[model samples]
Target: MAANNLRGQVLSLYSRLLRMSRNWNATNPAETIVERQYIKEETMELFRKNKHHSEPFIIKECLKEAEARMTMAEHYRNPYPRPVNLPKRSFSKKEGKKIGKAIQKFNEQSRPIYIRSTDDAVGRSS
Candidate 1:
């Protein structure tokens, strides 16, 4: 499916990024680091430009190559924000049904809301 291909592409891209980061870390020389970063940025940019037409196989292969270059030293940063201890929103089915019924009743009693076609709406504005 198209969704599966999209997921694969994203996963591959992340894997490739991690690998390149590891390789850059391993070299440690200033010039190599800069070059590596530049190359990685370029690769990401190219991917962004042509992502619409990119095949799943190409994405997966690129990711595998990138992963091969990755190192443990490059993995220390936290990829996610610290978890917030916020209370979760809870809603019951009965509450949802009640709200839906109320909205339906209000809509039925009110004048119909008209949404003009995009071209008609734009022409009226002009």
Candidate 2:
């Protein structure tokens, strides 16, 4: 099954990351300790946090991101994640308060909701 394959991939990637953390060799002597600790902590935190997710596309995206990060680290000889340039948002105080309330309401929803991917639809209908 596809889920089984994804599970295997996740386990393999997790083990690889753990091993990498233990064996990390930094190009910059000053960054060795910081980068190693970061790799281990980030790996543990992100994997544990997302372990409960059942969405196949979400899992695949995470796996791709991890692989890309690993490749980038090897190429750059840096284990830390690259800084993202997020766009700045400028909301008025009133708008910000309203947005905050909306976010809180969304988070407090009682039931979990998921959008089924096309793959799920096709597989289930067969």
Tell me the TM-score of model 2.
0.65
Question: Which parts of model 1 are misplaced by more than 4 Å?
Answer: 26-28, 54-126
lDDT (0-100) at residue 7 of candidate 1? 75
lDDT of 1: 0.43
Candidate 1 has a TM-score of 0.33
lDDT by residue for model 1 (81-108), tens: 1232322332223643555655544433
lDDT of each: 0.43, 0.67
Clashing pairs in 2: none
TM-score of each: 0.33, 0.65
Error of 2 at 86 (Å): 6.8
lDDT winner: 2
Q: Candidate 2, residues 45-93: lDDT per residue as tens digits? A: 7687668778898788668767877777878898766654322432223
Q: Candidate 1, after superposition: displacement of residue 31 in Å?
A: 1.4
Inter-residue clash pairs, candidate 1: 19-70, 22-71
